[model samples]
Target chain A: MRITSQTTSDGVSEHLFTLDDIPGVIWSPSEGTAGRPLVLLGHGGGQHKKAEGLVARAHRYVKDCGFAVAAIDAPGHGDRPKVERHERLVADIRQRVTQGEALGSHIARYNVALAEQAVPEWQATLDALRELDHVGGPVGYWGASMGGAIGVPLVAAEPRITAAVLGLTGHESLTEAARRITVPVEFLLQWDDEMVPRDAGLALFDAFASREKTLHANPGRHAGVPAFELDSSARFFARHLLEDGGPAEVEESSARLDRS
Target chain B: MRITSQTTSDGVSEHLFTLDDIPGVIWSPSEGTAGRPLVLLGHGGGQHKKAEGLVARAHRYVKDCGFAVAAIDAPGHGDRPKVERHERLVADIRQRVTQGEALGSHIARYNVALAEQAVPEWQATLDALRELDHVGGPVGYWGASMGGAIGVPLVAAEPRITAAVLGLTGHESLTEAARRITVPVEFLLQWDDEMVPRDAGLALFDAFASREKTLHANPGRHAGVPAFELDSSARFFARHLLEDGGPAEVEESSARLDRS
Candidate 1:
């Protein structure tokens, strides 16, 4: 891992770096972070690692929970070079959007492809992030829409993530992955989401095998998730990640951290 | 209203009382409650004012938020004399339950009748409670199942109530009343509810005219609402009832309190 730039603002240290060719960023308290928990954020389609909402949420997680947070550009998002296949997929989705046709199948296909690559990238990034002195503790993932599309499979494949806040995208393509997940989950759904049908969202929430999953639904379109959810998310993460807090297994796992 | 008995325990003062023919109970901080907020809990069917769940929740509200809470026996329920009509309704419902027949229509009819008598009794109780030195403040309501059934109409009819936590019972009978309510609401739904159909619950939540409504859905049967919901309810009431706490109008209305 190579640190490209570092800056501190509002008591949070932002570090931009690259691992091989994958660009990513990590945020922590400006003061020394000895053993804070970590949260990984995945941005939506057409959004980058530092999307405005992602950055605000990162700040909240850092300040409210004293947790280190990180985000990385997906294979064709942010500063990453767009492959021909991804370009074609985006073009197809955009055309469908303009034609007022359903985007579920196309979006799901694109998301599946991204997850195939992004999951491995996230795994590698977690391996490297854990090696850092400031970012080594129980981990959580927060993502929605395309982020959720990718996250369903990633969380299924990654054992390091103990909990996740995922929703806003739903497809049969992701059902198997969702069923395999056993960690606690807080899933958000927009009741009137234009892109995702309400039944599909409800069905996806039903697919989660996690014994401690919750669904928070609100009245809005695809992009109008209520602000109070941020507060709820902060609490959810705190309940699962912080030492002397959350699940006993989390604290037990922290005790087992090798931190070598 | 006449106070029949009063006891103090666990930092909460419990008072048993009667207004006319109505029997009820009130809970508040054992210490003098000067201007704390108030919450009204409506009990479920086959249960009374001092039902185990209602008493537990009342203590929580008093201890956690320093709020006064109250509950009343609905007509033909809990220390109230059962009339021939109520007996016939109960017999019908019991038979339906035994035969595995749908009880939606029968239950809705029974709830509608109870609400008519219950709403007036509640308003009278509120009027009397607010006259006490420790019980005058902004008002909220919490009830589910039959409590929700009666509560839908009561909250709709009572302008003094500014927010509510209601769910677990859904039917067309309550649709009109639900639409008339504009207060902030937190609606709960058990995904696999045995009594209420999923669509009916979703429809009722959708019928609420409150601009700020949230739906918390979990995978469980009707009687399996998770315990964390109690904590969430306390925060919801706190946000809407306390001075400088919730909606602007609630505070404005409190300032308008004559206290005569």
Candidate 2:
């Protein structure tokens, strides 16, 4: 879809946006209440958002479950600067390898920078949402493959993120990124995948200490996400991000809880 | 090294060669008293001959154990057709893929063509090799990753190949091609690799019902082939392809075999 800036709910305002310079389409649901919760989506390696089945499934979850979603490209992927031309991106990656930085630490720093840049772009979108008087404040994140790789650090660093779902990605230090994720997390794996081995995927899952964590595995390949698993991922984000009858419910309940 | 033609003491006498068309150096060891056995070395994905430790080790076995070696490039890989326009390559790939062909199968066809094309160019080189008197006959084959994928079909179809070492690449079927390979085989795998998952590799190995066979697994990633595995792989081919040895020695040898 064409990336452009526009406002909804009577067009009282406008937002800034751009086409994913990468190879995928990012779709923001047109039907969410003002102040609704926001969920961000990321894509995998050699794949744009449109290529990853999980990202599209995630959009469904946010839309039907009553949340706004923001899908963006990962570094050296999607619309972000090409890994070859972006010296900072390359140097950052080199530093991680040369210094022997923990996988988690390296991923955290890279993801934070990715989010820092994209989050502002998202802010304008969120601002438009906030102006609509329907969107919520609690933001969530989701990704698969390289997208999942970026999702981890983004959620961990951004305390505002309420929950996350990562698929076909997440493993122990790839080169040197040790995964130390704290946000509520969910992981999905393919039992007989050739692109990414199952053991590595499991090791990444085990490293996380999140009490609200889940692992899902199904028969598939590196090429596509299974349909059943996608449904499960949607259910997960719904439980944490969309429950409470939308932002109005949270706003109303917080007042009562604060009074009590 | 530049690609050139070469002939050997093998009864076949003349064979083409091209060091410039492929990524690594080519060495033609002197033939034994009898016709020298030929061993072709294949490389893994995103890698050339020198990148994988096993390729060099295999070369050593060919040298010390009396076997001839020819290391060639897969399509779109190494030095062959290096200056071709991207559009031409993509169109060729699309044409192949549209015909319901795997990238490897097309690559195998391309490699065979290159081999045939190099024949005229390699005549002088072959004459020099014959003067040096190395390699008694046609050629045997071995490869990992893309090399392995190409080797599977090539060995099965080409009668000149007496045996093969199929490293990290294999799949159940390749387009319209299906046949039992008559030659002896050996397969290698990395237990924790994220690329070319172990299962797909194993399936390819199983498809080859070689009465004489060996399987080895080491701790590493897609690019992590240890220096020692080559010795084992070479030993495998040596037993089956070398004139002095046979299946009986393979079964008796203590090569630290891992069936899984």
Best by lDDT: 1
**iRMSD of all candidate structures:** 13.7, 26.8
User: Mind giving the per-residue lDDT tens digits that candidate 1 earns over A181-226?
Assistant: 9998999999889988998898899999998888899999999998
The C-alpha TM-scores of every prediction are 0.91, 0.37
Grade the docking of candidate 2. Answer: incorrect
lDDT, model 2, position A249: 38
For each candidate in the order shown, give its overall lDDT on alpha carbons. 0.87, 0.52
